[model samples]
Target: MKIQGKTALVTGASRGIGRAIALELAQQGIRRLLLVARNRQRLAEVAAEIERQGVLVVTLVLDLTQIVGVNIAIARAWRSYGPIDLLVNCAGVAHQAPFLESKLQNLQEEIATNLMGMYTMTRLIGRRMAARREGTIVNVSSLMGKVAAPTMASYSATKFGIVGFTQALRGELAPQNIRVMALLPSLTDTDMARGLQLFRWVLPMTPQQVAKVLVAKLEKNSSEILVGWQSHLAIWCQRFFPSLLEKVLRIVAPLSLSRSKSFGEIANRQQATGNRKGFWRIVLDFGFFRSNIQTFDKGFDQGLKDKFPD
Candidate 1:
């Protein structure tokens, strides 16, 4: 709908697709933005960029799983910054690994941040919007939500949950005149994606591309907006050739080992990383890492072995 002069709140605004979307919203003439993330420095960096575009910005360093804090923060932001007309739930964490190798902690983190966090934000803002009877909400899912991938089982489950929520919420909020939509971006070239093993043929889209598509699609009545040509083709294949698509997915799935030896062994092999970067800091600090890191290391080591055969 109409974005100009409206205020929006975007979670995960510290980086990746969320940051890009926040910037694009500013560019689209949204009057104000309330940016939320766990990292204050990154949020400030994003706020600076958005301010350059002349958008009023308010940044909140938050961990959405904290229910009471979220309640207080959201109420305060609404009172201080004014009511948010649009809410974009984009905060998420991904940990890729074989189902058997997955950890409960990582899965909990995924569900907590991706699904519960979105739910909390939506519920808080949604009630206000429903009262006012005019607002828009966008849930950022992933292509993996539509087509599950092998190494990314838990992450896929959380995304599927988001897609499900978007669908159900759309029906639930329709009578109140509040709009709910899903944005599915395929294999985005984000910090989270880079930590995983690359699939054979699929290409990753930049966060900016995803943001541009979201902004453009908001003008339409479409319930789901998917980014990139690859996503469209994959979804089309999934719709028509389910069996063949499964086979193709298997062929392109990343390498996985049958067993994990030990956590220490995996940590040592992380030598490939001289100094872990910002992404790793976020994940590790949040306890968001899984056997996926080990899986990636082993796969990388095995690929080297296969290529040079010592």
Candidate 2:
């Protein structure tokens, strides 16, 4: 878990937390850094910064969803830069909209980038780590993964999926001496988060702050990491005071999205979209009252966790 002399591969490294983590790893004396993202220019800029810090940096411009391309690039990188000692699955995307009005394309994109994207990278790198019998994997999931948010149903679902994936891997890969973990950072001030209306009572942390916490937690060998006092407090409420937290979420949720529409109009709109199923079932799938019911005793919760939205 030590950063010094480690070879780390960070996805979504073009901007946001991934970018910050790459820089932080360099500052921490990481021997080799592999930065992955779709933006060639941005990835190159990040690699340049790390190179200035005297870290051997490599950048890969490939989409995570493209499995074959990712496999090829990662294989080449491992051959050229040596094995990756740390794998950070920080690549993700978010689409915010009311479930009823949400586009199918948006949800598909979210799944492709957030969930399956993590799956693809983790699977490929995980095999290598297991064979080597030593490595650390940090999956950057979000606070939204712990609590469902209004108008963010699709995004929340993907984040929740990430938590589940990380947990399963944690147990399955433990025998190989590979440490799989999750880092839950609450509302971070980033390009993707800036577009959404801020939730009440939420103090957004900067990407650098989250990155710093990641490194600190890595040293402790924490299977799961939460950033800042805000994340700790939020998860505390979620575990001991479920009802209170749910009520707070309802009050802060951005339900004012379609304020111009009446109830009858909304019902009619749903009917038009061929939503003739039972109301409660649709509500369940839509994430209404969809809370993660679990005991998060001292950051050991497995119920939920998002990737870097850079």
Candidate 3:
């Protein structure tokens, strides 16, 4: 769909990928934007920036985990902006713990925020889009959604659910002329990654880069766009060599376990005083997987160049 003059609602717009998407949309001349997130102050800051760009901006303080709040926010956006021309479901959370030690609550929270919340929001907005017969929905998924990773079972499960959900929604919405697209970005440099203590790998794309790719792909109504070469490799490996992939993951599992143990120590120390600070301390000390990022970035850039080859 053409973004110019369109109205868009973007969840998790306070920072990271969502923030980048909002800015990109604004740059495209999408004159009206509804920014949704739980932090009112941050949401206001984002709105201010977008408004400064000379576009209409609406900010909604919403905890997507609360179904009622999401519904209310959708209603408010509809009342304010009329029918939403685009809906970007970007709010999500991740928690990493050993399968045996992970609590039921943690898993449930992941499912609720990442899976069910998207389901709820999509159902509400999708019905309106169908009725209008003109809209676009972009669901931000992850590489983990395609491959199961050690200590990220819960995250992987939620992402996998997104892939299925987006694909199914795409098929269902095809007849209505409303496009449903899934943008599967691999490790990205974002606050969510910092919160999850996942700084060991090189993130192939910055949030801005991912946003650029997403906007370009959305223009074409692509069903799914995987953002990085590593992601493409993971999908291919899973398809052609599942057993070898499992063996390789087993070999690399120990390094992941060691990192998790270190994070667990920090968690324990902080828990004693109810302060969960210094969780990212290890990333600075051990120089995060910068080489991996360079490698992935080079591959991604080369692939893009080859495909576009201007």
Q: Estimate each model's TM-score.
A: 0.83, 0.82, 0.81
Q: What is the lDDT of candidate 2?
A: 0.80
Q: What C-alpha lDDT, on a 0 to 100 scale, does residue 209 get in candidate 1?
A: 96
Model 1 stretches with alpha carbons more than 4 Å out: 257-310
The residue pairs found clashing in candidate 1 are: none
Name the candidate that leads on TM-score: 1
Candidate 2 residues 1-310, lDDT tens each?
7889889999999998999988888888899999999999999999998899899888899999999999999899888888899999999887778788989999999999999889999999999999999999999999888878787899989888888999999999999999999988988867777667545445567799999889878888687788888778878878866666666676556656544222233344556886655344334433444542222221233222211123
All candidates: CA RMSD (Å): 9.5, 12.2, 8.4
Tens digits of per-residue lDDT, candidate 3, 1-310, equal 7888889989889998999999999988897998888899889998899899999998888888888877887887798679899999999988777788788998998898888878888899999999988889998889888888777888889999999999898888989998998888987767767555443433336789889998888778588889878788878867866655554454333355445434334445556767633434434434444324454455556655655679
Clashes of 3: 0
By lDDT, the best candidate is 1
Which lDDT value does model 1 have at 192? 70
lDDT of 1 by residue, 207-251 (tens): 999999999988899799988999999998788666556766765
Model 3 segments beyond 4 Å from truth? Answer: 199-204, 252-310
Question: TM-score: which is higher, 1 or 2?
Answer: 1
User: Candidate 3, TM-score vs. the true structure?
Assistant: 0.81
Residues forming the 10-long window of minimal summed lDDT in candidate 3:
282-291
Ranking by lDDT: 1, 2, 3
- Which pairs of residues collide in candidate 2? 140-306, 141-306, 142-305, 142-306
